[model samples]
Every structure is written in C-alpha cells, then in structure tokens.
Target: MAAKKNILLIIADDLGRNLGVCGESKIKTPNLDDLAAQGTYFDMAFASTASCSGSRSVIQSGLHTHETGQLGLLRGFQGLHYFTTFDHVETSPKVFNSLGYLTGIINKVHVGPAECYPWRVREESSTRDVAWTAQRSAAFFERAKEEDKPFFLTVGYIDPHRDLTRGGFGNTQDYPGVEHLPYDPKDVTIPFFLSDVPEVRQELAEYYSAVWRMDQGVGMLLQELHRAGLDESTLVMFTSDNGPPFVNSKSTLYDAGVRLPMIIRTPGCTPGIVNPNLVSFIDILPTFLNWAGFANVKGNRKGRSVLSIMSETSPLDDWGQVFGSHTFHELTAYYPTRYMRTKRFKYHRNVAWQLDFPFPGDLYGAVSWEGMRNAEPAMIGKRPVANYIKRGPEELFDLENDPEEVHNLANDPEYNETLLDMRKALEAWQLETEDPWFFRDGISTRVIFNHIDAGMKMPDRWDFDVNSPGSKDGAIMPHSFKEVRGRGAM
Candidate 1:
C-alpha cells in the first residue's frame, strides 16, 4: 500500500565531475555532495552524444541521437531553433503526459518542437535566476497536488555552461539569495585533457563560480520538494547534458566529452552506494518508464532500465560497454563521428575525417581559445594543436594505458588484432543501430543500397583507395539497410 512515486530530474548544462563527490575538483558542490551521500553515484555513466540537444534528446527518448533526429542545438546563441526532435518521436514528456502524470519543465528547454514534447506546464527560458526557478517549481508541486495526480518535473539549470562569450561562464549576473563562491584561479583543478595554462585556470575559476550558482539552484529545487512534503515518495536524479563547455570536452567524442557525472536518489533504495555500472543517457527514459509502472510496454528504445541496478557497487559483465554518436553541435558544426567504448578500449570512426573538426560557436569565442590560438605553437591540454585539429579516419585507444587518449593504437602493429576486433565490433554496432555513417570508399553505404542491389561492384574497404580502387572480384556484398534496420540481419 505505497503511494505512487514522483520523479524529479535536474539537468545541469555543460557540467563535468568537478565537485566534492568526485574528489578531483577544487570546486565545492556541497548540495551535490549531500545528494550523492544519500543516493547512488554512478561512476561510469556516459552521454550518448557530446552535443547538448543530441545528448538531451537521447536522455528523453531512450534512443540514440541518430535515431531521435535531434542532431544538434535546437536553439543557438542567437536564439534560432535549428535541429529539433522530430514530431514522430515519443519523448519522455509526451510519454508521461499520455499517462496520468502531470509533466512540467522549468528553465532551459533545450529539446524542442512544442508539439513533440507536449509538456503540461512548459515555461522554457534561459533566465539564470535560481530563486525564480525554485518558485515556479514550488507552484508546480502545489498544482500537481491540487490536480490530484503524480508528477514528473524536469528543472533544467543553465549553469557551469559557457556564456555567450568565453570570457566567463554565466557568472556576471548578480542574484539576491545565492551565495557568491568565487574560486581562485590557482586553487582550481585543471582537467587532464585541457591545459595547465593561466588562461585556462582563469576560465576554470569563472566556471567554478557558475557551478556554485547552479548548485544553489539544485539546493533550492530540492528545498521546494521537501517543503511540499514529497520527499520520501520522489525519485530524484541529478546530471548534466554533456561534459564541460571547454574545447576538448563539450563537442568531442573522447571520454572527457562523453563521460559524465550521474547521481540518482530512488525511494526505498539503500543510500550512499557508489555504483560502478556503465550506464547511458538513453537508459534514463527507460528508467522513468520502469518507475511509472510501464516497463512491460516498452517500444523501440535501445536502453535498459538502470532502476534494477541502482544499488550495485561493482561493474556488471553485461553493462561493460557503451555507444555514442555526434554529427553536429550548432547548425554549422558538422563532423560526423560514432564510437564504441568498452570497459578498457575506445574506437572512434570519424566518417568525415577529411574536414578539420569544427569548434562550437561559444567555445570558439571564449577567452581560453583565444589564448591557445596565440600561443607560439598552440595546444589543447596534453594534445598538440595539429593533433586535435586534423584526425585520422579511425582511432583506437587502450584507455587503461592512455587515459588521456593521446596515443592512437589504430595504426600500431602491436595491436593489429585488437584494432581489427574493435573495428568489426564497431561496425556490428553501427549495423545494429542502423547508422547511416557506415561508409565504404568515402560513401555512406546506407544511401547506396539500391545501386548495390542493382549489381554495382564496390570495394570492401571502409574508405575508397586512390591507389587501387576497382574491386569487381573481391567486393564483398553487404546486406541492405532495410534488412539491417528491421533487425533482420547483422
């Protein structure tokens, strides 16, 4: 005879594991620390994509970014809506609204096409006023009580994110209630991927200030839930959209970009368990579905519910790998990349490797980038400026040996078998996901299915070889996209 459980999902924009719980950050996130102390802190949770809208859409849809059609930013810095979630997609808000729950989103509605989300109380804005957001959340809880229905509320806090420029992270505004916890540039912890330069530290200090502000928002949002007397019956989760809004972290497919901090507080679960299970952002919607008593009725979602393993403290054999896709960040930042990350290895298949990787508009304008650009020979963290810019088509990294992913083992003869095995495994995943980026000879094989069926001979190589292109005899015919997409073939 238990009451129906409510769900509160708080998404922090452009955040990383720079908190007290991670024990790696100099930034003090007391509220998050308190939450992790009473919740399951996932050690290996990852984002489906490193871009904002792509990752958030995966979170809401329980599908990969490629499947959701939310390929990049729905709203850019200039207030333009570009890549939105398709109308055909069944997002979490739509799903919960279809059920009996009252769904509402306050602050930062990154995923869009209003018809697709169908939020009952959608007040989407980028106001950095934490107090106002908390006030709205309190009103939402009261309204849900008045309507006599269980609720699902998403409080999107835009903090720790880069401002319109890179000079500061959303830290210029003054608020009446939130405390001003300014970080000293010298004391902040420098990310391993990014640099140890003074300019990066200055930006990190500003980023820490923004994080403090965002932590205040979390503290405020949770206070409202407690004041509403809905504490014990609510499943609260705190996480970020992607990684930190830095050069190498935000829009890239490396571990610094995709690996994120995840903390979930579920009712009736034992508190303070540090779970090491490899979870994906896509798993969140399925977790919500399982929480709403609809686990048996899942559709084409690609993730399993993490609710069953919230208390686990060690990595499970089955949950040892994750996959990701990143095609765009803004409307113009197009560099199609897909990856398969196992427990110890990561394989990146950059389809458009010919084009130099694009920078996010905001990151490009940041003061940090300016400093790096002016350096005698610019570099990003441990990587050289040239290495970070122009990349090879395939990259394989043994994460255990090279945690920074600076060393590419794709071409190394010592790991030839490992390289081949990873490539085949990644291709199989691309087949399973029906990714259009599956290429052969510089062309997407998905689009050439008809020509392939018409008996046009093609090379078996991933990319077209200029030295010896013709493969009339050795060409291995691949299955059609229709067959593979329908789960009929692999």
Candidate 2:
C-alpha cells in the first residue's frame, strides 16, 4: 500500500487574491510565494460563501453555502439554524483519527452550536494562556513524529481581518508608520461603502502588517516540519477563509469576497504551476480525502477531488462555474444573495432585499441602535446620492471588462438573454440546495433590529462601543447604564 500523505492545512482569515505570487507586487508573502513555486496555484479559486462561518462550513462539508445554511456569524435568537461542517460530514479530525493518524486543530475552528461539543475535538488553547499559532502547530507535528503516524493538522490564523476590536489583533494603534503597499488608495477599488481616505489607508497598512506577522507564524511551522524531517512527506496547503474585510468583499458575493489565494505543495508533485481553472472551497475536503487514500468516505459532500488537476494528469480545459452566496451578517440583516461565476462573467442575485437599503454600509451599522457604528461615508450618509435611491434587485457584471464590478449589466438590453440565463441558473441552484429561504418564515426588518440590539449586549471581546445617537423605526435610541444593565429587552 502507498504511504498516506500527511496533510497540513493553514488558513488565514479574510485573505483576498492579493499576494506577491498572484502577480501583485504590493504584498510580501514569501512563504506563500515559495509554496506556490513548489506546488500548484489555483488562480481563480473562490470560497463557497463570503462570511467566515459560512465559508468554513462549506470548506469542511464539501457543500455549498445554500446547502449548509450556516450563513451568519450569530444565529440571532434563531438558535443556530445553519448546518456546519461538523454537523454534516464525519469530522475532518475524526476521519484522520479513524485512520489512526494523529489529528489536531490550532486556533479558530468556529463551527456549529457553540454550547455543544459534538465531534469532541480537542482545543490547544485556554482563556488564560492562549496558544500561539506556531507553538501549538509545532507541538502537533512533534506528537505526529513520536507516534510515527501520518498527521492531518489545521492551523487557523486570525490576521488581516478587522483588527482585534472585533476578534482581531486589535493592536493597530501600536503599529504606526508601517508603509502602505503599492495598491493606491484611489485605485483600491471595491463594490460598496467607504471611499479612499487617510483612515482607510492607515487601516490597509495595518492589515498588511498583520499579514506579515502571520507569515512569521507560517515560517515557524515550516521550520519545525523541516527539523522533524516530515517536509518531504507532508502535503502543505495554504489558503484563507475568504477575501479582505473591505465593504462588498467580506460579507457579500463579489469576487473580492469569494476569490481567495490557494497554494498546495506536495513534495513529489508538480512545482511552480499556475492552474487558471475555477475551483471551489468545497473541493479541498475531497482532495484531502483522496490524498489520504480514503476515496470512499461516505457523506453528502458536493465536491470532486482536484488531485488530478494538481498532478498535471488532468487537462485544464474549461472547469465548470463556481458558486457563492450570503445569508446573514453580524447579528441583524439577512440578505440572501447567490452568485454564478464562469471564466468570463459573474452574475449576482439579491433575492431577499430587492431595494438595497444600506448594503456594505450596514456591515458596521448606520445608526447606533446597538453599540455598532461604522465610520465609513455610507454609514454617515455622505456618499454621492444615486437616482435609483437603492441598488437593483439583481446584478450582472462582465468581469472581463469590469473586473472591479463598477457597472451593473443586469438591466442592459443587449445582455437580456445572458441575464435570463443566469437567473435560471441561480434559481436552479437554490432549488437543488433546498435552501431555507425557499420555505422559511419571512425575516422582517424589525426582527433584524432586535437581533442587533441583542448582539450589542455580548459584543465580541474586540468590539468597540458605538456611542453615536441614532433611531430605529423612529424610536429613541436605547441607553446603556450601569444600573440598567441587562434590563432592556432585545
């Protein structure tokens, strides 16, 4: 029998397709660049969903976002309706564990009901003494060496997301004078919210700094693997959960939200090959299973192994379309948007919110109903007013021309046929996935506000207080006082 390949999956949070290896000279990703040189780089790779939890769910289950229903961050008093990666498949760790391979996870594994530990996965960190990424990963590799068993390890890094205020590094205040990369702020184009400003530029610089720090962590893990003499046998895959946290990127269905950098390195496999074929995040699960010599594992996984493509045995002819979607963000708001991406064009459909009240802007919240407020122009109502007063119900962008998605071609007379085709495609996908939106109770604007109010009470450790005054439904903003703590109803 062939020796099982040791799998090391390293995932960076909110990393976009911006990297030195991807021909972007702005960012410094030497480790990733080197990995791409040794293995295959999937140029048009995309996440199943844009949000972290949603993307993670799809990656683990080998299912699409609509199929999994693990859309939003918080369940919003809905009590966690989404099916997670853990809820679907035999857990990734369990698969390796069953194979007698030492399996472990380091750092953020946010999936499924937080209160219930279904898979019995072990945590390498505690509240008081949180384990650093490199340290815990090195420890796992050491144990793998001692046991003489092939290992499947996942190291999750929380960097370049949104500095620590909302579960991020939160030390951007300290990292002053870090030079911004070559991507000009004026040309730092995105779909929605926030025009280029000094504050935005500074935030970008901090994000890059965090990326650099994450690279150090990767270096440490690689060094340890080299010392253990496992580098030759290990299959190292480096990727991110989703795109950068810029407006329409992180939580929406744009390319910036779904498109991610993926580098896979197998010692005996091909090197420095850039595969432009479209691939989904779900494909990782099957690829890993096949690499481990376990191709018949049972589950309702929806991805095919890309190992053939990686090995240069399969032709890189037109890969099929990749899909992405978004259901919920933060606590409030449920915008169900599905996307269909072929090599040339990308189509988006916002089924729930036909009139864009405040997309991208709503990410941080326009008013301070809860302790949530974004400093962006859209939130401040300072953006140039549009004639439509809202975005269209559906959107189609010719990615070949409008790579940044600055133009909406859905209503164009010339592209009417293309638009109809995409709509049918998206509808077919929704039906095939059996999406909850197809048969769920309507989600009202009021309910969304209530959830946001509830989230304010238990903001993540990194969140800052949004003290701005604003009203919801013309009602006075709720006050937070020491004596009235936990008294207000959500």
The estimated TM-scores of all candidates read 0.95, 0.76
TM-score: which candidate is best? 1
Note the clash tally of each candidate.
Answer: 4, 5
lDDT of 2 by residue, 20-85 (tens): 787766667787788788899988888877777778767666777666656666332345444443
* Residue range with the least summed lDDT across 10 consecutive positions in model 1: 481-490
Evaluate all candidate structures by whole-model CA lDDT and list the values in order.
Answer: 0.86, 0.64
Which tens-of-lDDT digit does each residue in 277-343 have in candidate 1? 7899989999988887889757788789999999898889999888899999987789999888888
Q: Candidate 2 regions off by >4 Å?
A: 74-89, 114-121, 124-131, 164-169, 172-194, 311-318, 355-389, 439-490
**All candidates: CA RMSD (Å):** 2.3, 12.2
Clashing pairs in 1: 166-366, 194-381, 441-463, 441-464
- TM-score (C-alpha) between model 2 and the true structure: 0.76
